[model samples]
Target: MTAAPHVPVNLADRLSRFSDLWSQKTVAGVNDYEVKIAKLKGEFVWHRHEDTDELFLVISGRLTIRLRDGDVVLEPGELFVVPRGAEHCPVADEETAILLLEPAGTLNTGDAGGPLTKAAEPLD
Candidate 1:
């Protein structure tokens, strides 16, 4: 038997070209779900996606997801999903690398925080 061909992804490779707070890099796409890597810092504006919900998995560092009433702190091995139409904010104490899975066109942030919230698009 033979193993599947694969490429190694180093942290430097994934994050070297991306430094923007919400800058994203497309890793892979399988059907309706898209996998992406994002570099996050500071605090993200509170918002929500009107359509499909969002999924997040931390690769390194720590992340905090703030909801309308409370927030959840996520470590490197944890995951979180914010339901559609629910306002939330993502904040990081330090630079954090995270993998996200969501339907195409799903915004990284949400709509509740006014104009700063961004609509989903290619990072590079």
Candidate 2:
């Protein structure tokens, strides 16, 4: 059997290239899952996708996931999962870069409001 083509992503390079809040690119995928890199700043919209759970991995800086019940802050090399149907909003004090892994078609913003409503942008 042959191996799939593999490429190493320079996380620092990607972060430096994209400074916009919530700019994403699709890296790779298989079946129903996909990997994405997103640069986030300020506060994101409050919303949730009922069909899929989202995984947030902090690549640099820090990220805070705000929820109705509580919130979680993720530092570099840290990660968290916001389960399906849970209301959440992501916020970064300065600039934050994260790798999001989830099923395809997961919405960036959940069901609430305040801008940031779009499908995941492929960041490869």
Candidate 3:
């Protein structure tokens, strides 16, 4: 197989390649972590990554991460980090695009696997 060429991972461009909710496409990587783009809608399952922290950066629309304590609402250009072992559920009022930074192979549903869980797929 040929190696992928280095290029910019345009958020809008990468996102347009898929339409499934909760779908995640790996765009790039740094060290042990991978930069992923996901298009989310509705409510995601309540899950937690036992061994890795998950970072969410909102690129478009609004995202609300519901924790046991409260809901963290993120708008465009906003970001939040959910620490390891913290159970949380993500909700989107509308179609939302987000960039996720987490360890490679980290499951989208984390410890709680169900129908929404998906294996990360590389964009290129």
Candidate 4:
């Protein structure tokens, strides 16, 4: 497929295209990584990316990254980078929108594949 050139990606506009929690859609690609967006709520399975860092940027609402030591809370416009191999589970009290950055083929659920795992789909 040919890339859509010169067009800007509007995060909120792209995010509105889906309502499923934990569903990820690839909005753009940067070299070997993909810029993805997801709507999140409740708790996600505990997992970790063994080879690549995961960046979570809150576009709207709040999210808590639950780590073994403690939890990192992120509000709108905030971001957190979970280092490679660091175990984490994301929790949101309310519906939240987020942007994720990781290697193109990185699994959303890491090694803890289950119902929450989502294969990246192209942005519609």
Q: How close is candidate 2 to the true structure, as a TM-score?
A: 0.85
| Alpha-carbon deviation at 79 in model 3, angstroms | 0.5
What is the full ranking by lDDT, best candidate first?
Answer: 4, 3, 2, 1
For residues 1-124, write the lDDT of model 1, one tens digit per residue: 1112575445457667667777666666668777778889899887778887788899889999999889899999899998888888899999999988888666565456455555544433
> Ten residues in a row with the worst lDDT in model 4?
1-10
Model 3: residues with Cα > 4 Å off, grouped in runs: 1-6
Q: Report RMSD for candidate 3.
A: 1.6
Estimated TM-score for each candidate? 0.79, 0.85, 0.94, 0.95
Assess each prediction's global lDDT (C-alpha) against the native. Answer: 0.76, 0.79, 0.91, 0.91
Among all windows of 10 consecutive residues in model 1, the one with the lowest summed lDDT is 1-10
Query: Which of the predicted structures, 1 or 2, would earn the higher TM-score when compared with the native?
Result: 2
TM-score leader: 4
Error of 1 at 95 (Å): 0.5
Q: Tell me the lDDT of model 2 at 103.
A: 81
Off by over 4 Å in 4: 1-3
Candidate 4 global lDDT: 0.91
Residues 40-77 of candidate 2: C-alpha lDDT, one tens digit per residue: 88987778878788999999889999999999999999
Model 4: per-residue Cα lDDT over 1-124, one tens digit each: 2247877888878887788888889998899889999999999999999999999999998999999899999999999999999999999999999999999999999988888887988885
Give the better candidate number (3 or 4) by TM-score: 4
Stretches of candidate 2 exceeding 4 Å from the true structure: 1-4, 112-114
Supply the TM-score for candidate 4: 0.95
In the order shown, the candidates' Cα RMSDs to the true structure are: 4.6, 3.4, 1.6, 1.2
